[model samples]
Target chain A: MTENNEYAVECEGLGRVYRSRSLLGQSRETVALQDLNLQIPKGTVFGVLGPNGAGKTTTIRILSTLLSATTGTARVLGYDVVKEGREVRKNIGIILGGDRGFYGRLTGKENLRYFAALNHIKPRDTDRIIDDSLAQAGLADQQKTLVEQYSRGMKQRLHVARGLLTDPGVVFMDEPTLGLDPLGAQELRQRIPALVGQGKTVLLTTHYMFEADSLCSRIAIINKGKLVALGTPAEIKRNFSSIGVIELTLNQTRPSLQEELTGLDGVKRATTSADGVYQKLTVHVVAGADLSDKIAEVVGKDHIENMVARDPTLEEAYLEIID
Target chain B: MRNFFVQAYLSYRGLFLWLNWTAYISNVVLRPILMLLMFALVGKFAADSDAAQAYMIGMIGYAIPVILLGGILQSFVYERVFGTISFIYSSPGSRVAVFFSRGVLHFPNSILACALSFLFGWLVLSLDLSTLNWWTMIVSVLLTAAACTAFALFLGNFTMMLGEFFNLYNAAMGLFLAMTGVIIPIASLPWFFGDLANGIPLTHGLVALRGAFAGMDIGAVRDELLLEALVGLGYAIAGIVVYMLVERDARARSSLERSPA
Candidate 1:
């Protein structure tokens, strides 16, 4: 009778409301998530893209059974996240953001062993699993070092090691590359696809649009605690094909120049940025509209240093949707 | 059972593996001896020979419970402050196992503290031990540890539920210390306070331990040991129930990821 057994994770009408009391004794309710729906297919990397307070962490917390939903239901691997929490926990690994979660006094290998024990991984396999995890996280050489002595990137890798100790079928990573350097982030990104290649499902949350576009098989965009769009990266990009984007740089852009360009008949949207020396402008054109004459008529060619027009990237499409 | 021991050992390592040899020695040995000396000096001037003997035995008997229970309570607070409580809660293991695992470190520490304190009092204080019943003392010390551990487990759950209550709980340790009759007789207090002492674990434990240390016959202290064990059982059940309830509430409130504090 289940609707989405083939999916690794499915949630319907998921909502969470936090209650707080003010000094005046008036109760205030903050809705962290509301009427959210999601379905992550098995063995695929699914990305949840959103700004902060957009319910990304709340969704992961609910799916991991670390928090209960106020309305609706969520399931993982055909088991209800709330009703069969233990079963859900058994099949999933979680890595939340921040470096404060682990015991700094423990060694990297020791932390993995502790989590492995807590997860009830077989005793005979504990050593093998820990060694494999440490190696996978690129910490085998430094496994004996205390966690407090590790750099931020090393600790983040240790988080990955801890998450993989159980070999979970599904992994929830909330902003896993949040504080890492570019090289560290690239290395972690390389490891995520391997998990999916092994028939594991990865649910990743990130604010970085490029990361989502390149790493995820499907991307879901959430804004203000609501899902605004859900589709594959190509599909999301294709949705904006009716519009064209133009990049225009000026020696110095005046405030009135941007207003006049925005007021042009064929221009759909105009965004401007001034870098003190040069003004960079992005202009979106409506489909089937010729904006060259309109741009020429609005501002003289002398004001424009360089101008090029092209299709939108995922980031542009995202800004178009959210803005 | 294997998981329990593994967890216990890992947790012990987490709290102590980073310490240097001297810090480790101080933590496990020197600190307890110093505490015993301070108590011995207090007993020397405060009362007559008979009262001083009672004070020495009472302090030595209850030292482990106070030290270990206090440490267990502080570790729970530190777990919340360090943001690891959420990690433990999200694990697939039973909450009971995690609670006991995190609290188990203090178990051996308590036993060692009691032994060192006992030795220090016996040697430096020159207390008469001719009639001491080693078997009964051993049993009483273990029972006292169990009872106090059970009590700390309850407090751990309570402080975990309301994170800010940790400060209040830490400040109340003195109240529990005074009420447990370690340094003062429970009977000397008013009737209400004396009756309240019966509800706290370790009061009867201290009474039974005093009997063992004074070389009283086991028959004379059998009732105290039984009462101590029964109290321990009651708190164990109550502690488990409270833990489950608070854990459920925390899950509902989304407090596990970040404590209310």
Candidate 2:
């Protein structure tokens, strides 16, 4: 179920700003987010993909109801995050700004118990929740060990367990794998989607593109407090997709071809590679024009070989979209 | 309300004391033995056990305020500055379950730590706590904790670091030394100085706290006892109100962004 209609989270112009003194001791207003609109469909893992400081944390903060929107309105699970905050908190589970919600001295079992009590689980039910949570967190064996002793990866796992403590309809994980070892990072990437498999909606934010590609059902990329792109990974890639690349391997230094290739009617752009034995040239032609024929006839078999035409990658499209 | 403090107390109870004590609290357990050696060497200490016993009782009275300030209230500061406060804040239950909710748990922590430290001091100094009125002493210890927790919580509002806790601790202790009759009795001081001490919460608190050390009837010190409890509770509530306002600004969130408050 798409969270848009089932609507786990919806935002209309959410924003956050911080006022800080600059290096020169000048007061400056840094707008972390501004006029940003967003929607996360229920049961889907919606990702907020952005470079660091793209307001991902700020956005997650608002939707999780840990934050109140300065200007716009946001709702989580049909509850207005600002006005009906208690209900919003009831519907969504959040692990925002990474590992901010844990006590170091409490053992894994104790930590879960404390959080469960605060979440209002009845005394008898709390024991079951703690048992289930320690197991779910994969900290079952180490449940008796204090949180301070747990490695960074283990703390993150506990954070996920705590997020699921309420069994809410929607969940939020910010930088889900921010400071994990490769194995741990990969482990978290898999663990996140399992919540969705059980029909829980997830809203996640990450700086890793691969994480988004591997996990998100749809993504919204915010740049400088604005929504730069919003769509499915495939759909977004297609929006900026490009084709027609001519790759070449050459032996000689041809500085003169720079002008000839640049001025050519079929060639769009040309640049020499570091090896001096390779050149990559791309051409965007007027639809009716034939550039392949021009390359074969004009460039003359001497310098060009390993020539290939291919569609651009999502990586390239993402760069082009942002640039 | 009961559950809130239960969570807060249980959440923080042993961890903080263990944290401070494991480092030096217990390591100094032998200090009283060392002091006994000195007392044996000094003629003024007396061969009579009462002199050595008085030293222990006095030590307990002195350590009460120090442990109260450092052990609990400081830990609360760490809990917040380190971000564990957010964990508690996210929960649905009352933040005001007093001690359990951690809304004003600091005052209680300080008070309880004071009692614990005094007990430690008693054993170390070879004091005669054996004849002490257990019930009255317990009440005094709790009152001392409540008062100090309020003080620490009040000071915590001004800074974000545990170092700030020390700053507040030192300032309060200096003021405390003259008031609690920990050093000299406030009654011995000149009238102006005595009046300042009389009005302070610690003054009223120590009146009860010191009475417990004397093995006296604590509840009978009625008016001063009630006044101190009211003052501690008042400070706690007022401190919480200030914290709520200041912390709201600190949280800022998007609400602050749109409103710029």
Candidate 3:
């Protein structure tokens, strides 16, 4: 058990490698997470941001005691994740998103009652705990409805309610708002701070930069099984303050233009996207470097309709780090 | 105890896909009856009424494993398919409670299947029940169901480990039908098969059941009953052990969410 209560989650040199063997007896190994370290403080919503296959889910799995770390140690709420798994499990709730993790035939309330029993909630307190969780997730009225009949948003809300059944001190949510409508996503996002306000620590993994920027107190961006950046959203953006983005609207796009812009000195990345009759070019460059002359030379000035230069957003910073 | 019953009922209702009245009636009720009728009719045509009566009782014994195995296996398979097995493992719940509760409802379902087979034999085939020792017969059926359920739970671990559901189910069903003296007398078989029958569930239980139908007293089949209960207990303990081993292996392989093929 951890001696410090300030941090709800702590890991040092944590690593995991998956090995598989083919029918022909050839073996291969893939490193899913490598020498990763994180310390999440109590009562905060810490976000983990990464590209696909970037070890986000792997980290969550190790911390929640669903998988063991091959190398180092992880502690959750003062309990070792591997050695004291039951204690860790008792203090944590894991919400894996998607439509698959529920019993479609059972009503939402019945599902909660069943899980409550699995958590060994006192029989006398089961109903009240379930009711409080349902009301918290804003699904109190729809509790009796079969989960198969629920909309995706309702199912996601029910997932939230289920995670709260034990009233765990630490909650791990993986892409909680994935596949939700804008309004539904917003509603779920609004509940995060309320959880933190009640002294619960939340570890969230998401791909949405705007969502992380708005809700997370700190964010870690990992790529290819490595942590590339970690800090507050503003601090992450500020680390790239020396970076600037130039957006240009063109009448037409040519493949050669992208290569030409990327070849320019001080240019980090040049990407093009088609929007209706025009094309949008986003160029990331060093802040002080004057690439206007070189860019104008690559594409004729007459073809340039709109141009704007500004500091990079968190999304742009994440893209640059991932690249 | 509350958790045990709650988990049992919810898992059966949620994970068993054949819970609907129509599917339940067709699969659990009609299918077993059809099997009993077909086998009894074949035996009568092939030999005589005495042979037909033997086949009917054999079918009753066979129904225990058939119903219990499918019911218990389906519960584990659907839990993997629906991706709830990880939650079950990650919870702080007692593993013993969760493990045993899976077979709770299935045990009674198998007993119910046996009773239906016995009823069909008595009413349609004009089988004599007046000579049957009702007490011993009931105990035999209960013991048979318990033993088969325990064996099925033990087999259920392989479905998750091997990642194949129906293939394993078919293999086990074939093994039980052929090796457990379901339709054949162990004495007439080769010596090796007779020894094999001793380890398989439903073999001794069926013998005791037949003895009960012949109006034997409890003392006459006491050894068989004790062996049947011991077999059930052995499988139950083995199932729990194998479940913990599988849980450990799943954590090592990180394959809890990977469903059986």
Candidate 4:
């Protein structure tokens, strides 16, 4: 596996253990990544989905050579992440969810220029690279403005620009849509596929299920530093085909409603959504189980207006896998 | 070499241009002068005019290190606070090289601030340049700048490795200003401080600067220059070792996954 260069990234039993100090100086160790194995092929859009602390960022950082795994081996373009870290760094780029990556004091163009220099872009090629990146990020017009003056969305765009300054073969995007308005997130989302079209491998981690469902060619759902499921969206949903989905519209929803619904026999997961007047509840149950009567009994017929039994969605499949 | 200079220039422009000239001058120049003025006043009352002139030169010597210290603190803090450490560390560029590039970038400003401080001293304090040993004065000042910049690079790398310690930097600068013969002659102080002065970079540098301005021969000040150089070398080695250790730990522990900010 270590000898193979066919895959963009390959990890075999990679793990990271962190030791931190408490306020009273008590030492604690945290296992951020367990013995995880993944083989991400070239030019594919891979999505890693997990709740916070599930090791999504750890995996990305390790593969990007920003961090090293304490145990096992990982490789990027067949170069060991720990041993050939500089080579790995040269081949990859990363965009974090947080807005604190660039120098706010510098202009957008200046920031890109600086990163270009760091990347060792030839002096003659620096300006052209900066211009191309700024144009690609849609910041060419505003490139002269200080980054501090740019909006959060604009800065995020600039981040993507800097990430591409090196023209890396693989790009790791960790929750890129984390703190953006709907339109802003949608705009960034629209820009991702273009990278794929250019034959650049992209590894994206997002909490937004729809973002994963829409963008990823392959999605891996992780929980507690373990890979719970890895497959295409259709394949993952098909694997959970035995889990039936029941939707209910009730007059009022209580926080305990999900817990009560999960308590019913054969029900694996339950979630609630509110839309102004109606409270929408979704439950995943075993396909053969008779959940209809119990769901009605739990919600009461007076409170239940509408109910629909259907197949599980990508999100329901994800929840069922994680659960 | 080309990449290094480019990065250095970028670091300089990114940092210094952020603050307007007025703010830069007032903070970097005016504050140090005010501190010097207090010492100058003391020199006038407690000692003769030559001592006063020595105070002026010493005050000028103190300003560059202060600027260098400030620049180091700001650059390291900016990366950590702005969450750019991961971006920089992940780059293909050598981390040590990047650290020095920023340190090098701040050198010119340090030089400029020191030059302005001296100009202010010459005009306001009635300083006479002809009596000074021009060769010794030039050599000492340049060597001091080199030593100070090296020390600042050490601090920058240390902060990068640890991910915090702006307070430590503050304490260090304070100690340098108070105890490095900048405001007080080491010989006049108690034996411990005077002995401790040999270990700090600015001590020998400042001592050599005073000797130069008092028309001391180059041969007479060679020992001080050599000591200053040795201190700078010690800091360079320490900084490199600490930075590499921290970098190794960061890799093993995956600290970048946990945001320092």
TM-score per candidate, in order?
0.92, 0.77, 0.93, 0.89
Among these predicted structures, which one has the highest DockQ? 3
Comparing 2 and 4 on lDDT, the stronger one: 4
Q: What local lDDT does model 2 show for residue A156? A: 83
- Residues B1-261 of candidate 2 have per-residue lDDT tens digits of 444655766555523544455644442333323433454334234556655444444334445455555545555566654465555545555555523244244444344444554555555444556557777767765665566566555555553333236667677767766665554567788768887775455667666655665677866665667877887777777767766665465456322212111
lDDT: worst 10-residue window of model 1 chain B: B11-20
CA lDDT for candidate 2 = 0.64
Ranking by lDDT: 3, 4, 1, 2
Which one wins on lDDT? 3
Which digits, one per residue and each the tens of the lDDT, describe model 2 over residues A1-323? 12345677888877877777779999998888998877777789988866678788888877766665677888788777767877776676777535445677778888787777777778778888878877866779999898878887788878878888888788888886776778868877787778888889888888777788778899887777778888888776655334335555555445666566657775555556755546654443332345776665556677666566554444544555555
Q: Per-residue lDDT of B126-172 in model 3, one digit per residue for the tens?
A: 66676799888899889888888889889888876666568888888
In order of DockQ, best first, we have: 3, 1, 4, 2
Worst 10 residues of 3 chain A by lDDT: A235-244
TM-score-superior candidate, 1 or 2: 1
lDDT of 3 by residue, A37-95 (tens): 88899999999999999999999999998998898898988899888999999999988
Clashes of 1: 0
Summing lDDT over every window of 10 consecutive residues in candidate 2 chain A, give the lowest-scoring window.
A280-289
* lDDT (10s digit) by residue, model 4, range A204-230: 999888999999999888788888788
Candidate 3 CAPRI level: medium
